[model samples]
Target: MLVTAEGAVRIWTINLPKAGNAITGADFIAAFEAAVDAANRDTGVCAVVLTGAGKIFSAGGNVREMADRKGMFGLPAIEQRYAYVDGIQRIPRALARLEVPLIAAVNGPAIGAGCDLAMMCDIRVASERATFAESFVTLGLVPGDGGTWFLQRAIGYERAAELTFTGKTLDAATARNWGLVSRVVPHEELMPTALELAGQIAENPPRALRMAKRLLQESRTGALESTLGMAAAMQPLAHHDDEHDRRIAKWRSA
Candidate 1:
């Protein structure tokens, strides 16, 4: 089930059966993409919180389906492999595109692609019981999803290489220490804390928040001079908004 809720905040929850919640192929990806588009278009929504409903956040891909596809010979196998990688890559890339602040309320084990999904979010607040691992190596696979990119940027190449090569699992606290997660909370408090953080972000001027997100993302790859030029271009757009006046007046009074 893909659940979407609206308020000062928008929540998108992915609920899959206990059997396994592997994201299958293009159909599942389309549905999630549509959900994201709808949420972004919603003028009433200021921020979004994503979480999974179950003991595990997501199992990554359907193992049974993978086994079935692997048996098919020749070009079919190669096509399936590419399709699988494409499907995996889309999930995290979609999160990175969200205009509003994205909060990952991690509830449990986030393995492989699941780990990639959480890491893609702007902020990650995890349940105490939550565990994260890049288990691709364990399965004789390289990180196919955006994990390779996210891990390296979030913690640097050395740490990302270490984690991926060993396929080591980190508890919430250790993940936080490694800068993989923003915060860790008691299991029962995870959702509430994440919502609170989302709510606070929601209260900020929307345009400014969006620009800030863009600037930060741009700064990651762009030179300082280029970032400054980008910010200069963005300032005019922000100044014309109603929120700008309110901020200027508030600052003047202060």
Candidate 2:
């Protein structure tokens, strides 16, 4: 992965173009996890964008390895389950820790776990050439990357089920219509559009943006009262933030 910064936003590019930016094994996850940690620790980084180095955003798993019964696909059924727990499952957990907005700039085909990866982001913007597929079923396999959960949350249970069962591929426009991706731009414009959105998000006060992100995350699963109570707890801290005060002052000046 190649990580670069633009003002308050960080762009992470998956660099395995030769393999269609396929993500697999321990090393990739560890590095990605570390990158997320680094972004969180840096107060200056208020937003992030993830994209691929070449045409494909991600191929998801390594098909060649799966065919060879190597790595996570090796051995007994029970061991395969454990391998998932220690391997791919860790991605959602790592992404869950991000305090700011995460944008997936889907440049091309996001197949199977790749589709799940895009779903894991807080926002998704796709190139006109981009495609998404929950393709595990086509391979006579199931989603081993928490696509079960993420897919439903992204495009509703019914839509998710259809894709999962049929392993149908969706074009960028179809993905946007189904609410999987927020926007679909011409392929050449994808990165520019994503970066522009990231800049908009990055301009906000960092602490407040983080608090809003946290609240938004909790609202998805928490009950009404619990979510409100959590917001109440965070509001006072936001009220006391120096940056918030500065923003207020700037507004008054305007």
Candidate 3:
């Protein structure tokens, strides 16, 4: 994994190009968790862009490792369950805890767990060369890494069901049409587009951005009344923020 910062925006590149950027063992997850933890503590980081090192965004799990049953797949049923809980699952958990925005710059094919990984982000920007598939069924396995939940929320139940059941891939255009990705750009322009969007988001007051994201997350699972109540509760805090006052003053002057 490679992490770099551009002002308030951080970029995380999955750097295993030769392996099709597949997520293999626990090390990658551990590293991701560490990076996210560090970012959460760093007030300078307001937004993050996730992408792959090479042409392929991610192939998902390591097929070779699965075939050989040499890693997570090799453990006993109970141990394997524990492995997922303590390992790859940590990625989504960490993402959930991230208050800042995350943008997935899908540069190529995102398959199986890779598709789920992109779904975990707050927004997705796809390259024209990008494709997505929920292909766990093709491997005779289910989406154990929370793909079922994330996919359904991302693209709706029917579409998620069809993709998961058929393992059919959707091109960038189709994904945008389905609302799986917000935008599609040429491969060469993917990172710039993603960073540009992240920069726009990062331009907002940091505390307000985090609170707004929290509200969005709550609205996903909370009732209208509850969300409204939460919004009411947060309004005073926003009003009291010095950045909010500064922005208001600047707007008045302009």
By TM-score, the best candidate is 2
Clashes of 1: 0
At residue 214, give the lDDT of candidate 3: 94
Model 1 has an lDDT value of: 0.79
Q: Write the per-residue lDDT of candidate 2 for residues 1-254, one digit (tens) a residue.
A: 89999999999998888877877768888889989999999999999999998889999999999899887677799988888888888889999889989999999999998899999999999999999999999999999889999999999999999999999999989999999999999999999999999999998999899999999998988999999999999999999999989989999999
User: lDDT (CA) for every model shown?
Assistant: 0.79, 0.93, 0.92
Ranking of models by lDDT: 2, 3, 1
**Cα lDDT tens digits for candidate 1, 1-254:** 47566566888776775635555456667777777787678766788888888877766766666556542112475785776557666777676677788888988888887887777888889998889888888878777776888888888899889889999999989999999888889999988898899889988888788888889998988999999999999999998999989988999999
Model 2 global lDDT (CA atoms, 0 to 1): 0.93
Lowest summed lDDT over 10 consecutive residues: which window, candidate 2?
19-28
Best by lDDT: 2
- Per-residue error for 157 in candidate 1, Å, reads 1.6
Query: What is candidate 3's local distance difference test score?
Result: 0.92
Q: CA shift at 110, candidate 1, in angstroms? A: 0.2
lDDT of 3 by residue, 120-223 (tens): 99999999999999999998999988999899999899999999999999999999999999999999999999999999999999889988999999999899
